[model samples]
Target: MKIETQCLHEGYEPGNGEPRALPIYQSTTFTYDSTEHIGKLFDLAAEGHMYSRISNPTVDCVERKIAALEGGVGALLTSSGQAATLIAVLNICSAGDHIIASSSIYGGTFNLLDVTLRRYGIECSFIDPENGDAAIEALFRANTKLVFGETIANPAITVFDIERFAKLAHRNGVPLVVDNTFATPVLCRPFEFGADIVIHSTTKYMDGHAVQIGGVIVDSGNFCWTAERFPGLTEPDSSYHGVAYTRDFGRAAYITKARVQLMRDLGASPTAMGAFLLNLGLETLPLRMERHCANAERIAAYLSTHQKVEFVKYPKLPGNAYYERAMKYLPLGASGVIAFSIRGGRERAVRFMDALTLASNVVHVADIRTCVLHPASATHRQMTDAQLEAAGITPGLIRLSVGLEHIDDILADIAQALEQA
Candidate 1:
């Protein structure tokens, strides 16, 4: 099925008497008629739900929908965006393993890789996105298991060159893992450009109404797990009675291991309630994305013309460094996020955000309502001045998440706020 059809019909098929809408299977455990059948599930010899922590029917439906949308063999939903990132890496990496990641990602993700993961003996080297292919390839070591980056980085809004990153990763026999949270599948499908795995903070665009907090990891199923570097999947696992994930699961090796192993141990599975809400939000995603792009383009143009605006960093605008790349990867739209700097620095940036009436000042983005935030003050506050500059977050920069409101109204709100700034 095509993307539009898949969004509505791919995951769940209604039987003659079944509910048309995907129902929430809220039970924690599924009953089996025979102990032998239950044994097969626990041994990973069969495909069926044994426990909610390992898998849930309601969450499985949503995961299938997301996997279809992302052009992946399978997907796993997690309790939060952070959990998704952790699971995606942990599935393939272990202690003493290393990763090469772009520096222009979310503050939380940066902290995870730079600080938290380091404590677990998983090291990461941060590289600039503009470093080009040779520079990126230089970061990879013999123990580097994966290369990670974002499609459109949070706050920074720099569009990654997917093809370039993919080439570098594959050359080193590693898979490229991308955070598709900002771009979403509607704007760009990373798998088409050779991304082996795609991760998302469904809390943002997927749940456009801001009704749920969730995340997902979609396995493209194109990478080879038989490589000697990854023995975890190709080799036997004593925990699962000497089962090899790659030998049994085939294309689903990555996500299957993530679910039966990491999810079972860590228990970061999403609830049926969150999955239901996310599916509801997915229904209108295509339509909402169109309005969001239109509104953001208008607002970016408005801000670019304002005297108080020092600079605008939206890819849709002409002369922007990422305009051509955005046109190639996200031709339909370059997302609803826009980053701009105010002429009066941080003080005026705060005033401008506070002056907005219709666009609320919030710590959220990619919602149905227009919202604005100063990354230097709010999201990226943990970074020092040098760290902020390195991430392209200036002291006066403001991040605007344009919503599905009328473009004129959104622009008017920004114009009024700029006047006050």
Candidate 2:
């Protein structure tokens, strides 16, 4: 089936004359017929769920749906997007490991890797994606376990070169992890371009209504874990009774370890109710993304020519920096988000956002309702001027997230805001 059909029918299958909607398996524990049967589950010999902390029927369905959408072998749902990143890295990396990440990632993720992960002995080197291949590759060392980058960067509105990065990682015997949150699977499936792992914060377009907070990690099951490279997977895991992941689970070693080991200890599993809502969002993703792209293209064109605007950045827009890469990766469109600079600097940008009536000046992005944010002052306020430049953030940059609203109304709001600015 195509992605649109898979979104609606991939994971859950109904019995004869049963309910069509995905059911929420609300129980915390499952019952077993005999003690010996339960023992097999505890020993990993059986695949039945015994605790909600590890898995649930409802959440499992969502995971499967996401896995199908991303063309991955398996997926794991987390309580939030942040947890997904943490688990995705920790599954392979240890205290002394290193990660090479693009500097254009979301600010929250930047802090997580540069500060929190460093606290745990995991060090990260942030490199600008625009840097030449040699400069970026030189950051990799023997300790480098993986390469991390965003598919369509958050506020920067730049697209990462997935095929290049994936090749760079594969050459160094490391997996390429792509955060495809902004450009949902409907627009671009990173796995098709050699990405080994894919991740998303379902709080974004996946849950278009902004109802639930969730995240998903999908493994393509392509990367091999040799003892010399990824000892964590090829070596015996003592916590699971000397079980080696690659030896037993084969293609699913990476994801299985994330669940049986990481999830078992950290417990960042999503609630069954959240999964139900996310499924609802996934059902309409294809339709909503079409409208989002259409509206954003019109808005970007308007912003580019406006008297009060300095420049506009939308990968789908012609003459934009990432238009070529976007055409290669996101032929459908570059999702809904766009970035533009008001003529005046920070003060003028804030003035324009405040003047808007239809579009909200909120802290959120990728929602069904149009929203705007000033990253330099709001999201990336903590960054110094030098740091902001490195992240492709200008003081006057306005991150405008186009919504599914009608083109006329959305344009009218922007026209009025530009007049005020």
Candidate 3:
């Protein structure tokens, strides 16, 4: 099926007598015929729902759809984007392992890797991804188990070099994990560019209405997990009755381990209601993304010529640094995100944001309604000036998430706000 058709028809195709829409299986547990049946599920010898904590029918449908969208073997949904990142990393990396990640990423994820994950004994190196391949390789060590980057980084709007990073990770005997929240599969499928794993904050474009907060991790099932390299997947798991993941699950080892091990232990599974809402968003994703990219292009063009705007960063804009790379990977469009700096710095940025009429001021992005945020003051407030610079977040930078509204109205709102500033 085409992507648009897959959005609506991939995961759950109701039978002749079944409900048309995906039903919400809201129960916490499922029934079985006998003790032997339930025991087989517990022993990992059978396939069926056992508990909502590990899996649920409602959430599974969403997961399967996302997996199909990204061309992956399987997907696992989590409570939030943060939970998704945590489990994706811990599934492979242990306490003594290391990770090489691009410095340009969401602030919440930055904190997770730089501060929180470090305390757990996993060391991380933040590199400038624009640097040449040799420079990136310099940061890798023998114990480095994975590499990470965002498709289109938050706040900065820098487009990542997925193929470059993927090759670097593969050469070092690791898999490349990309956060594809900004440029969803409609714009770019990272798997085609060699990304081994794809992740998303489903709270963003996948849940465009902002009605749900969830995340998902999709494994491409292309990377090799050999016994000599990844003992965790290839060797026996004494915790689960000595069952080896790679031996039993084949290409699905990563996702299976992530579900039964991390999710079962952390209990970060999405709520049934949340999954239902997310599925609704996914159904309209292709339509919404078309408008999002179109509006973003027009808005970026308007901001580029604005007197009060100091700079604008949108990959679709011709003069932007990532324009060429974006054309290669995001030919359809680069989603709705745009970042610009106000002329008067942070104070003026704040003034302009407060004066907006049609646009909103919120701590969120990728919503159905246009909204703006100041990274220095809100999302990246916890980072120091040096850290902020490393992440490509300037004090005057204003991250604008353009919506499906008419381009004229959106520009008028920005124009009036600029006059107020």
Candidate 4:
């Protein structure tokens, strides 16, 4: 089935007398008749959920749907996108390991890698995506485990060259993990372009209604894990009674280890209710994304031509830095977010946002309702001047998340706001 149909029909199917809508299995534990069967589950020899801390029926259905959507062997849902990223890294990396990530990622993610993960002895090197192959390649060390980047970088509005980075990572014997939050599967499937793993903050496009916060990590099952490079997968996991993941689960080793080990211990699993809501959102992702892209395209064009605008950074716009790359990767659309700087810098930017009557000045993005944010003072406030510069951020930068609202109204609001600025 195509993605549109898959969104609705992939996850759950009701039989004979069963309800048509996906049911919420809200209980925390599953019951089994035999003690031996429960042991099989505990030993990773069975396909059943024993505890909600590990998995649930509703959440499992959503995971399967997301995995199918991304063409992955399996997926694990988490409480939030942060938990998914942390678990994805820790599942394959250790204390002395190194990570290479694009400098233009979400600010919270940058802080996670640059500060929190460093405290645990795992070092990360941030490289500019446009620094060319040689510069990015120089950051890789023998200790490097994976290459990380975003499909459409948060707020920066730059498109990541997935195939280019994937080749770089593969040449160095590392897998490439991409954050697909902005360019969700509906827009771009990183796996088709050589990415080994894909992740998304369902709180964005997948949960278009902005009703829930969730994340998922999807394993492409394409990376070849060996004892030499990934002992965590090839070696015995004492936590699971000495089960070697690669040997036991084969293509699903990485995700299985993530679920049974990291998610199991960290307890970042999503609730069944959350999964149900996410499924509802997924059913209309293709439709919503279509509107989002159309609306954003119009908004970007208006901003680019506006007299008060210093510059516009929408990949779909002609002559934009990432226009060619976006055409290749995000042909369907560049999602809803647009980044443009005001002419008079930070003060004018704030004035414009404050003057807006329709668009909410919220700290959120990709919601069904239009919103805007000043990243430098809000999301990227924690970053140093040098870090902000490296991230392609300026004092006047504004992230406008174009929603599904009528284009005329959104533009009218922006036009009035710009006049006030």
Candidate 5:
């Protein structure tokens, strides 16, 4: 099936007389007549959900759908995108290990790597993605476990060179983990560009209605886990009856370890109802992404020509810094986000956001309803000046999330907001 058809039919197929829609399995525990069967589940020898904390019928379906969409061997759903990132790294990394990440990632994620993870004795080196391969290659330490980047950065709208970075990571014998939140699978699949792992904040574009907050990590099953680099996968896991993941699960080692090990301990599994709502959003993802791209292109063009706008940073715009790379990585659309600054600084930017009547001023992005946010004040506020600059956020920058609303109305609202500013 094509991607559009796969959106609706890939995850859950109705059996005879079953409901056409994916049914929500709300119960946390499944019944088994034999104690030996339950033992098999605890030992990782069974293929069933033993507890909701580890897996669920509804959530498993969504994970499978996303894995299929991303062309991954398997996936694991998490309570939020942060949890997914934490587990994605922790699944392969431990205390004293090192990580290499692009500086242009979401502020929250940057904090996770820079601040919180440092307390855990895991050091991370933030490299400029614009820096050439030689510069990036120099950041890799002997203990580096993985390289991380975002396909399309949040607020910055900078396009990451996925294939270039992937090759660099492969050269260092580390897998490339890409955050594909802004560019959903409908727009770009990082796995096809040599990413070994793909992650998404399902709270954003995937749940188009903004009804639920969720996330997922998809494993490409392409990286080799050497015992020297990833003992957790190649060596015996005493916590799981001495089960060596790569030896036992083969291509599924990464995701399987992520689920049974980190997820089991962290307990960040999504609720069954949350997964149900996410599936509803997934069913219409292809259609929604198409509309989002079309609307965003027009908005970026309009903002670029505006006198009050300092500059527009949407890859769809001609002559944009990331245009060529976007064309190579994201041919369908650049998703429904644009980053631009006002002529004045933060004060006028705030005024513009407040003046907007049609677009919402909220702490979210990629919703069906249009919204705007000032990065320096809201999302990226915790970052220092140097960190903010590294993320490409100016004091006057506004992150506009173009929605499915009619372009004329959206443009009219922006004009009025500019007038007020």
Candidate 6:
């Protein structure tokens, strides 16, 4: 089936008397017939849910749906987008291990890598995505376990060159992990371009209604953990009774490890109710994405010609740096988010945001209602001046998350805001 069809029908199949809609299996634990059967689950000798922290029926259905949507072998849903990033790295990386990440990413993720994870003895090297191959490769050391970047960076809206990053990572015997939150699977599937693992904050576009907070990590199942570089997977796992993940699980070594080991300990599993809402959102992702792209393209065009606008950064627009890459990766449409600078800097930018009557000034993005945010003041305030500059968030830059509203109304609101600026 095509992607559109998969979005609606791939995950769950109901029998004769079963309900058509995915039901919420909200219980924290599942029952078993015998003590021996339960023992097998705890030993990892068999696959059956014993606790919600590890897995749930409703959440599994959504995970399967997303796995199909992104063309991955398996996926694991987490409590939030941040949790997915943390587990994705921790599954392979240990306290002494390191990661190479693009500087252009969500501010929250930056803090997590730079501060919180560092405290745990996991160090991260931040590099500019625009820095050519040599600079990126230089950051990789023997301790480097993963290469991390976003498919389409949040707030910055710059597109990462996946193929180049993937090649660099593969050469160094590390898997490329991409945050595919902004450019949902409908826009770009990173696995097609050699990405080993794809992660998403389903709280954004996948939920679409801004109702739930959830994240997911999808394994392409292409990275070989038995490769000489990764001794962790090939070696016996003492926690799992000397079972070597690669030997037992084969292609699903990464995700299986994340579930049985990381999720078991960290306990960042999503609620079954949240997964049910996410499933409903996924059903309409293809249609909503088409409208989002169309609306974003129209708004970007209008901003480009506006008198108060200094520049607009959207891959769909011609003359943008990422247009070619976007064409290759996101041929369908770039995404809903767009970044632009208002002519007069910080004060004018704030005024423009305040002047808007139709678009909301909200903390979220990728929702049915159009929303705007000033990263320097709102989201990226935790970062210092240098950090803000590195993330491509200027004092005057404003991020507009285009919604599915009528094109004329959206354009009119933006036009008025520009006039006020």
lDDT of 1 at 283: 85
Q: Candidate 6 versus the native: TM-score?
A: 0.98
What tens-digit string does per-residue lDDT give for candidate 3 at 243-286? 89999999999999999988988899999999999999999999
- For model 5, how does the per-residue alpha-carbon lDDT over 1-421 read when each residue is reduced to its tens digit? 7889889998788899999999899988999989999999999998899999999998999899999999999999999999999999999988999999999999999999999999998999999999988899889888999999999999899999999999999999999999999999999999999999999999999998989999999999999989999999999999999999999999999999999999999999999999999999999999999999999999999999989999999998999998999999999999999999998899999999999999999999999999999999988999999999999999999999999999899999999999999
Please report how far candidate 1 places residue 417 from its true position, in Å. 1.2
Error of 3 at 165 (Å): 0.8
Task: List model 2 lDDT by residue over 44-113, tens digit each.
Answer: 8899899999999999988999999999999999999999999999999999999999999998899899
Please tell me which model should have the higher lDDT, number 5 or number 6.
5
Runs with alpha carbons beyond 4 Å of true place in candidate 6: 226-229
Residue 372 lDDT (model 5): 96
Which residue window of length 10 is worst by lDDT in model 4?
Answer: 301-310
Looking at candidate 4, what is the lDDT of residue 244? Answer: 98
- Give the Å error, residue 285, model 2: 0.4
Residue 330 Cα positional deviation in candidate 2, in Å, after optimal superposition = 0.5
* TM-scores for every predicted model: 0.98, 0.99, 0.99, 0.99, 0.99, 0.98
Instruction: Name the regions of candidate 1 deviating beyond 4 angstroms.
Output: none
Q: Taking the tens digit of each residue's C-alpha lDDT, what string does model 6 give over 303-421?
A: 99988899999999999999999999999999899999998899999999998988999999999789999999998999999989999988899999999999999989988887788
Local accuracy of candidate 1 as per-residue lDDT tens digits, 1-421: 7676777887888899999999999899999899999999888878899999888999999999999999999999999899999999999888999999998999989989988999999999999899867777778898999999999999898999998899889989999999999889989999999999999999999998878889999999999875589999999989999989889889989889998999999999899999999999888888888888888888888888888899999999988899999999889888899999999799999999999999989889999999989998788888888878879999899999998888878888888888889
Residue lDDT tens for model 4, 235-332: 99998899999999999999999999998889998999999999999999999999999999999998888888999999999999899999999999
Worst 10 residues of 1 by lDDT: 1-10
Summed over model 4, clashes come to 0
